[model samples]
Target: MGSLRTCSRSACERAAVATLTFVYSDSTAVLGPLATYAEPHCYDLCTSHAERLTVPRGWEVVRLALPTTPQEPHPDDLVALVNAVREAATDRNQDTGPGVRGSKGTLEPPAGAGAGGARRGHLRILREQ
Candidate 1:
């Protein structure tokens, strides 16, 4: 089951109903419906915050109309999600194959993997534009 996304505003614990993305090149801010997945560079906002959103001086704000009612996930979306999870699990198992375990029964990064080497982690750092 999926968990509710919270607003990105400080001390605001309201459920997010919109996603805010900034287009630096156009000096524009886009406020749209909640994204399927959370993005590092985007902000998730509640209805109130989204409605009251303000952009920097000279910046344009583009508001995308949100749906009046929540909708169920499509079958295709559910299938895709399941496939992605299975692929990730397969990849993880392959990386931590036999003899790659630490003495403490923990998985160790494969040869030449990690910081200053091949990336092997559940989380990835997004590069700034």
Candidate 2:
């Protein structure tokens, strides 16, 4: 949601249309569509630079084509978001009491939920690659 970044080329002020990344160890140059977030070591390139990009002596240039249809929020997404907000604003917010997270990331079932009937309470965090 921050401001859009422009090309890194000197004296050429244009909205960055692609991202340029170089892998020094692999001798590869990846020039693709702009990333969701700006990276510190990556270079932002405009359309001209993206099309006329070049690689180093033995480096391979991998150009990625951007998707044609932008994935903006559709009507269904808006309706779902609105419904979620309305649900959170209603009485459902009072069900979640404090001490939801146990001593060390343990799943302590909510009040008045049997051992194994159904998952009445929700929200579990799992770390997987």
Clashes of each: 0, 0
Predicted model with the maximum TM-score: 1
Structure candidate 1, residue pairs in collision:
none
All candidates: CA RMSD in angstroms?
Answer: 12.2, 12.5
**What does candidate 1's lDDT look like per residue over 1-129, in tens digits?**
322888999999988889999999999999999998999999998888999999889999999997665555679987998679657766776777646763222233455454643343654333223
**What is each predicted model's overall lDDT from 0 to 1?**
0.77, 0.69
**Most accurate candidate by lDDT:** 1
Indicate the residue-level lDDT of 111 in model 2: 59
- The 10-residue segment of model 2 with minimum total lDDT is 99-108
